[model samples]
Target: MVSTPLPPADEKAVWVRSMFDRIAPRYDRFNDLLSAGVHRRWRARTIDALAPTGGETFLDLCAGTMDLAVAISERAPGARVAAADFSIRMLASGREKAAATPGPVHPVAADALALPFPDAAFDGCTIGFGLRNLADYSQGLAEMQRVLAPGGRLVVLEFTTPPGKVFRALYHGYFHHVLPRAGALVSHDSAAARYLPESVKAFPDVRSLARLLREAGFDRVRYRYLTGGIAALHHGVRP
Candidate 1:
């Protein structure tokens, strides 16, 4: 499979936000179709990694549509889950979804790099499928570490390039070609789907990501690759 080059730095975030806004209506549906419903399981695993206790203040960064936030609320009923996103449209959709759920999630519009919160404000944080879009992913990771209290856990779930030679070839083909086409057909935004593959290719992988987390002042940094390395859940502590 031919690798598609990453988009330039200046245009990447703008393109990603625009694409997400365009696909916001069908976002959940597209995710279900794209990942064959496995994203739900991945989210469950991510929430499990965080292991939120009741009554803790949890922050879900880049909480696109609040999937992770809702999952956290369900898993830890007494926990207060706050969802933050830079895109107003995405936050609006997430708020609407949260309104229907049993547990209430506070939705806030905020940037990932410069989170609007006091230091060490949250007990735990989770970000799913949203880190790749940040202009400075390292800075975003640092902000996540900053907002967490001492010993607070940070969980990040993201797509990654598969490792096996044959499977990697097949995955790349599907990611770059088939996914874009199907996503365009379903969401009516080809650029958004195209951006997905590009962003994954550009984002740091598990090993490098763990290093970045440590650099951002996190300790006990570790990651588990899921689905044969096509995705990963990275964890760290704010020590």
Candidate 2:
């Protein structure tokens, strides 16, 4: 199979949306298999950072399959979670799960860089394994900040390079080599699968992303590496 480079910045969002739509059918399952179900633990940690209480409104931006939204709903039971994503088919794939969640999970078609809601719309916000896919990380972070209420917490969970050299080398070997092939086999879209590692490679590191959150006007920024630094969970608050 031929390896395709990631789309240029001007065309990224459109290409990403279409790619996700094409892979929506196998996205969840492939994730489960590839990460050996550890992605769930990472997401659980993200929710821990968000610390949702009952009766709050939350936005799960770039929520491809509403995984975080449903998890938050299940955790708080009285929260209303909006699962916003630009890819309609990706959101559609999670409809059943959202419907069955304890709290209401509303799926909305929204661009991360241009969210449709008014300012201060949510009590908390989260983006899990999704923020890196945004065409403009700064703009996306700004939009997330804009919709959050004063003191609203923002939690971001994303793939990152490990700090340990040996672990990093081994992880990169599998991540860049094995995982893409497996993802392509499962999703039946080699380019989309290849985009996964390329996207992660192109994204900022954990500390760099924390600095970005601060630069985007979030206060009290903090981050912690997860699962041997394979991923990171970042927390910040809107002042």
lDDT of 1 by residue, 60-135 (tens): 9999899999898988888898999877788777676688665668998888889999999999999999888888
User: Across residues 121-220, which tens digit of lDDT does each residue of candidate 2 receive?
Assistant: 9999999988898989999999999999999999999999999999999999899889889988989998887888888889999889999999999999
lDDT of 1: 0.87
Query: Residue 185 in model 1: shift from native, Å?
Result: 0.6
Stretches > 4 Å off in candidate 2:
1-3
TM-score per candidate:
0.95, 0.98
Index of the highest-lDDT prediction: 2
Residue pairs in collision within model 2: none
Tell me the deviation in Å of residue 77 in model 1. 0.8
